[model samples]
Target: DGGGVRGLSSLLILENLMHRLSPEKDILPCNVFRLIGGTSTGGIIAIMLGRLGMSVKDCITAYHSLSRDIFDGPWRPKAWQTSKKVLGLTGDAELRSRRLEEAICHIIARYLPAEEKSALFGEEEIDPCKTPICRVFVVATQQSNGRRVILRNYPIPYEASRDMTIVEACLATSAAPFVFAPLTAGPEGCRETYIDGGLGNNNPVAIVLQESRLLWPRQSVKSLVSIGTGARVPTEVKQNLMSLAKKVAEMIVDAANEARDFESNIRLTEPSIHSVYFRLDVAESMARIGLAEWRMLGAIAQRTRSWIFENHDLLNRCVVTLGGILLNCLCITLRYLSKC
Candidate 1:
């Protein structure tokens, strides 16, 4: 789901779902889903929708602008940076980290009110349990150690300190190696560097499930929707060390296979949950689009639209099920109001 520019596909799918859910007016995902989590580019999307309370259409537009602003320029790595890339060392990225930070800041400023903007983007720590809106979390990997950190807008069951700001969380999660420089931020003494979480936990469905259990120990999940950018095509590696290393690196960063394997495992272990679990992904056409192909937005949108059309029945079922849940919640709220 962290496929650089291919994030358009994920947004397109979400747009369709949101439109189907409320054909009349705009409905934000923050008001619908109790918990949302994603990695890398998906993490950015999660923040826009779940944390910022952005409508699907507005989020899609912001994503387009962000993609163009970030990827429109040419990237010519320095000689030393090229060598570092080949040797698997951290070096200068293809794009400047400042560009990404600025773009995200622009979006935050555009969407948030004046009174609330500073608090969300400032260095002040945010306790997820104290957030008034829906619970949200984004995954980012520690640069020093390969540990996965769950940057949450809600409480984790454990005793983890809330030391990160929302802006820092976004930048840290979106710092894909070789594409964007790793982000270094925090208080003076405890500053830490972070890169994209896709290298380890790309799909993030497992993380959502795990954290959901910790957040609500006795409750059962009624619906879990996992949307993907698209399926990746497998490539044959040459019989050489360099080619093998490159191939291994690609596999380690890619999440398509991991998503498929997890879905398969869910089907095998908990077939009964199939009725509640929904996975939507573009199966074909996207295999050829590279992750950094920002110019291929039109193509990605077309492919995702076609996939949605072909799977109308599944989408309908998902909409109906979620609508039922929404209606039930509304009824409970209405009953409480009547009692009051």
Candidate 2:
């Protein structure tokens, strides 16, 4: 899930899990998880961990740095400017999209190999067919058709061709509505504009499940972890027009309840996999924070820590199960090497 700067909560939760998995040393999630998918800010997290192969701690640090850089300037436009932009008289955004693109490019450059440096925004591909270490994808909503598109680092048969560069994929997925301009990408004469995937897929648990089934049709999923960016206070629906507008805006901004609904569906429909499915989300004090409140990092961290302490038992079980999965993967790889 993506909640602008609130994504810090997701990172904090993953950090706790990584610590529990390997207390003495750093264990990269890319080595343990087969596929990782995310949307909007969560998409950024997916790239940092799955595509760049960063440790959770390092990813947290990098997230802090880039968020500061991307959201450093004034984020709200003047009343007149906002009115004009909203009325379609202007296309300017309050925040500079270039800042976001540059920050993402810098991070990608730091991790990419020297030989692939020149292909940062060109023909460089990010797919399991090319780099089998970990499969990663970011979700985006196509503006023209209002359909969900997966910018994958792995190929899926019969899906749209995976010809976009890593930088383009990151840009498309992170293009939040109104906050940043939508990205127009693809080959000439076939371009499509893309906005944030959070419009309908703020919680991408369903996408992850569907994509996993497509990737491994015969194999049953062993573990599925759905991390969320803290929960929000539920709002009551009102009959007044102003209240209805407010409610609609809130729904567009954050889809906290959707995450819970998806979890419930998983448990009800697939009872057998329920034991292996883990959903970690902080439960209190997050509703007061705004999505773009970057200065509230301290409060976010504190809340996440408290939540972790409170749910120690649940986290421990998740860690133990993940550890077992890692061990099994190691054994399978060793057996294949022996056969070779």
Candidate 3:
């Protein structure tokens, strides 16, 4: 029903009443008071808002505290059990790795467009160390923990290139000490960035990153205003932007940290501990990278012949004895288990 002259007041009461009646168990009900203040609100409001959002966000923080309470959670359904049934009969390590990658890919697809998959600019997306001289390095972080560890390793020989600048638009998306190859500026020197994806045909998007540079578009202003024609970038607005940037920076660092810890845990739990050295086996990795180079190939061949001469036996094979045993210890016991 419409109120006569007091329509705004009636609407406000109704809205406030509804908010008050929302279930209390939701932990966080919407904070509507923020909208009530006039446009002249101080920078503190924006700062508080940034802090509030950061506090509410799910940062993958690791807590080593122990508790005696029983921990119980949800179980998987029949669909997952069926997938495991098929997975159990497979003995190929490559197949297992592919399957795991595929599952992760499924989730990635829902969020990202097709082009931004793991295969962009080589596998070492964010390697800390510089590459071999004569090529470019790329640091595209897929997912990360708080501050450390670039988790993927592509078998590629990095011949470093010269003249690189570590470019980051906002504090949040900045890389840690430049593991990736330095970003060489475009021929034009500086870029005119558009607000969103829209621009000319070649908009020149930066890489799909773990965190976005959320620099909001500045409001348009015109000199010699006629009542409401223009407004400059106020001091408060700039302060708010700074606050937001800081919060985002914290989130990015936390994401990198989480990814770091997860990779470490995966290495510790690997079926073969030797898999730990799989990335760093320079001889084997070099052979993989330079498979096409005849000179490198010959070098690897000579090395292989030398190794063979040193050891007489073949690289022995282990047959799969546990036939079609679809067992998942996830259903049994594991102290650490939580939904992402």
Best by lDDT: 1
lDDT of each: 0.77, 0.77, 0.21
Error of 3 at 318 (Å): 29
Candidate 1 positional error at 121, Å = 10
Q: How close is candidate 3 to the true structure, as a TM-score?
A: 0.17
lDDT of 1 by residue, 10-118 (tens): 8898889888999898777876787889899999999888888898889889888888887776555545444456676643353556777888888888887766743
How do the residues 136-248 of candidate 2 rate in per-residue lDDT, one tens digit apiece?
88889999898988888766777655577777777788777666788898779888899888888888888888988998899887888889887777689978655555455
Better of 1 and 3 by TM-score: 1
List TM-scores for all candidates, in order.
0.88, 0.88, 0.17
lDDT of 2: 0.77
lDDT of 1: 0.77
